[model samples]
Target: MQHHRGRTRIVGALSVVVATLAATLVPTVAANAITGADFDPGHIISDLQFYDNAAMSEAEIQSFLEARVAPTGCVTSNCLAAFKMDTFTRAADRNICTEYTGGSQESAARIIYKVQRACGISARVLLVTLQKEQSLLTATAPTSWQMTASMGYGCPDTAPCDAQFYGFYNQVYKAAWQFKRYSTPDPWGTYQPGNRYIQYNPNPDCGGSWVNIRNNATAALYNYTPYQPNAASLANLYGSGGSCGAHGNRNFWTYYHGWFGDPEYGGLPGVTVTRFDVANRYESSTRISQEAFPSAPVPVVYLATGHNYPDALTAGAAAARQGGPLLLIDGASIRPVVDAELKRLRPQRIVVVGGPESVPESVVQALSAYSPSVTRVGGADRYEVSRSLALTMNPQGPVNEVFVATGSNYPDALGAGMAAGYRKVPIVLVPGTDTALDAATADFIRRLAPQKITIVGGPVSVSPGVEAQLKTFAATTRVNGANRYEVSTNLARNLYATQRPTTVYLATGLTYPDALAGSVLAARKSAALLVSHPYCIHPSTLSAITDFKVNSVTLLGGPVSLAANVKYMVRCW
Candidate 1:
């Protein structure tokens, strides 16, 4: 039944042909061909039993065949199989008269339907098999022997075809029965799941791969042809390029796709999404932490200044290490989101990471409502706040590494936050657009004595003088981009080297609060946090998502903060 010419021999669970093709082989002229086997191996070819064959009439199959214009020059609606297939009374015909509608011409469609019902095989399978084996359906001028072995029922390449199974009715019925037998249990059955050593070609030297058969239809195809297309064969569509590769299965896929759209239609693999529904980013972070760290108790939650970016900028590292989310609050009082999350988390202690000025004493009093133990680590200004937070997180000694960003702007700091959090290293803020490092930041950097320091933004945000000063304390490395979006994408790429995260978070790059709170959430899940515009995804960010193959994306804020179109564009990836 394999589409090959000459010297066919059955050798140890393989049906192979030892001769060359009959020159009729040609490449299918089509665009968007499946150049590679990227599809899931378990994909179903078709739902064989999904079609209602009983409702199908002979007139329908005949009309369908007649409508298809043949490859050879022939009169419209006239072909050899349609007009002259039923020349003799076969075993299928007797049953067709008894069970199916009795016909006088013994039409081609009637034989196919009778064989389909008789052997419990699909008519579509028979039609495809017929064309595949002998080009019977599309060939305008076929030889008498071609019709005799229309389905290649009894043809063996080693010898002449067995004459007993000659004629269209016998061929179709026997072929359908053979396909049915493949699905049944037997010692000779090749359609079974397990490690199957399928050869790439008839030549023993060509070698093969171990394929794990997942379904009956794919098994049947392999059982019929007994060869798989190798990588070289697939590289060029026209032919195997003399590299001893089989084309039967490859042609089957190509033809099936051309005839019908995705052969594995409804059985494709699915993506998984983990969602967090909260009133704001405050609750969003807690919900994210709760989901990500389900078993971790005694979490060390970081309380940051919601009004400004200073306190929150340096808190990512500590929160990540403690397996907790950043809880943002107003300078005066605790937000309800933080209050509810505190009760839910029931942390042993809270590390408030800002000064009394940045996070007032009233907020500290309100935090004590949930936890009896609350420690405040802050200073007189933003730079001192960053220094105090770092020192508190690493009280034993100076940390080995730290990320430095502009205290005035949120983008650069937020861009570097998630990565810093993942590494559990603090983010120290420097004065933005300043000619030199402020006295507090400089003094703090000299004390910490970090081995490595990453400058997040360009010279415009943190000047060369500050970077040079930072270099005096540590091995300074700058991560700069043309803009904020590029910076975020570059940082994400560096953080998640080869790991493709299933979930990623997206927030507007133009603003900060949404992304500031979102950074901790994304870091907790070991996911990437990307920044984009309100209405559109940045090109570089979108490219990263596609390359990573991220399944689901969490938009940090509502439509106002991150526009509806941004979510739509991300989901499209």
Candidate 2:
């Protein structure tokens, strides 16, 4: 349990180990003398885009940590033990909940997952630090000293080690929270993209160098350690005494490389389309989707008429799951963007959603020029069209879940559809009236026999009668708010109740074109779409921003659809 010359140790036996560390360990300050040329700004420690652009779910983080084999020193030969230690639960307001999974909550993996999500920090980086600072991760039986100062966060070389920060949860939570604070823009914040003066040792004699931090994550690491490794120090991985060089940052880089390849991973391919001044909303929506998912020779593509919302409401999930984009068309002639996108995609099959009235036969025939395998899934009406699309996408088997939205309105269904898309579930269109479900919808519900039904919108959009009818088919839960803005917020909250969304998409509630196309992209990005007014953001949407602390916001459409001032407000929020 002794805190050696440059390493922090966590012992199981608290009192005995603390005395041992205090008596045996002499405070050793490592020098950080290095040249500015030694630094590579492009070679970041971690890429924020990896979290923002990629679909990093809680399950993914847990699985990654659990997959690692047990290190050399664990007494039980358990890798998860490395992440677990006794902690004062309520100390310093660090109340980590025990309940992560259902029934009986347990496991160190759960604790790491919760803290990582809560602080918006990567779990990969946390584990690397635990290993780098203490070797507690691989120790035969970690001492209380190592567990207490698990992250070596508060135990700086220049000052006395803080006693109040003792305990596993406190160390990890505070350390992760500090990393987040570093990324933030403040006068004291050091982890911004710029050249930072890092010292090798606390002593002025041990000169340091200026290193250019490429990204926030790399800058965050520098802010934590305030040092850069010299060539001599990095030459030997385990050796300590070498020309007054820091080992913390060096070990972190090496450990991360050995375990997870490159820490700065790639992001999803991004594309942007120009908003034409004369082009209608339908054309704009199609163009946006086409640019977003520019996969050539796609297997399938979803086509929905842009005049109404019902048919397109449920198409997002299916399109996202299939790695396809959602395209909007007029009732008769195909929009220029639609026609151009169809040519670019060259999909094997085009699935036209909606009735003949919504998307006419002429449009279906016009699609023959692009692909020979064009298939129309039109129904008797909008409700029937939704049913047909659902049946086609999910098939006639037991579905995981289904979303029921008011067929009459667009706002409730817009956000609901995006959520369903992200969840990869089917959404059914129900009558907006305060009455029984439509025959087509009811018949489809009975046929598919879903496990859960999420009804979107208030009583006016989807009445109690529909809820009762849905309950007979599956476990029903209604998500409603005072208005469409509130309803969108509620939908986002329900979908990502436990974790924050990777990014948020803000589109105008007055129009459907921007969000309709953005929904498919949002699902692919694993993001939440929140609809607001053209001029200002709703209070409910603002509440969501505060709750989740969402920093990334992508404004759908141009200033006309969502005002520039509104976009600014949303982003600043």
- How close is each model in CA RMSD to the real structure? 17.4, 21.3
Instruction: Please state the error at residue 4 of candidate 1 in Å.
Output: 56
Whole-model lDDT per candidate: 0.64, 0.65
Off by over 4 Å in 2: 1-279, 570-573
Tens digit per residue, CA lDDT, model 2, 1-573: 212122322112112222222122211112133333433533555454222211233454455444443333345423445454443343232332222222233345666655665666666677777777765444556677777777876786646668777766767777776776665545235446777677665445667777776677777676676666555554544344254656666666655545544444432223121222213576666655755676788888888877877667777767876778888887788867678888888888888887787788888888888887888887776677777776676775778888888878788888778888888777777776958886767888888888998988888888888888889998999898998888898999988898888777777899887788788888887778889776555678767866766656766765457542343342212
**Which candidate number has the best lDDT?**
2
Q: Model 1, 460: alpha-carbon shift in Å?
A: 0.9
Backbone clashes in candidate 2 total 17
